[model samples]
Target: MSDYLEMSLEQLQKEHAELLAFNEKLDRERNGYRKYAMKYAKKVQMIESLFVVPSDDHELTIKAIKTIVERVGES
Candidate 1:
């Protein structure tokens, strides 16, 4: 009975250590993913939310078209 009790205590200690390590790893991974998501979200807002589009004036549109054509030709 004493031997069985000792074995159980040892197994429980090992399990506790494993659980603590796993919890720390999960926390780090979650924080990394959250940081990456925030960065991606910032870029998405700039491009996808129409936040940086040019003005709708006719003169500006023409100039923009010319600039695009020039760049395309260069490419």
Candidate 2:
């Protein structure tokens, strides 16, 4: 704190600009993680939906599994 008091206006402005840039970088990274989490959550929900109702149709189960595998592969 006392060190800041000793800084010139130019120094303070430079430091402020650097901090702002770093903050923006962190925000971008946070947003990326948030998007990834949402995508993963949707995939998990899809998997859960498949099991929610017990289905005796083997063909339907196979199709669902194939769809899931394709989606996973795409990711």
Q: Pick the candidate with the highest TM-score.
A: 2
**What is the per-residue lDDT of model 1 for residues 1-75, given as tens digits with 9 covering 90 to 100?**
235455677787887798899999999999989987776665545444342665667676566555554553232
Q: Local error of candidate 1 at 62, Å?
A: 16
Candidate 2 CA-lDDT value = 0.83
Best-matching candidate per lDDT? 2
Q: What TM-score should be assigned to candidate 1? A: 0.55
lDDT of each: 0.65, 0.83
Clashing pairs in 1: none
Superposed model 2: Cα runs more than 4 Å off? 57-63, 72-75
Deviation in Å, model 2, residue 21 alpha carbon: 0.1
- What's the residue-level lDDT of 38 in candidate 2? 81
Query: Candidate 2's residue-wise lDDT over 1-75, tens digit each?
Result: 439989999999999999999999999999999988887777677878898888999798888877875685346
What are the clashing pairs of model 2?
none
Give TM per candidate. 0.55, 0.77
Name the lDDT value of residue 56 in candidate 2: 93
Q: After superposition on all CA atoms, what RMSD does each candidate show versus the true structure?
A: 9.8, 3.0
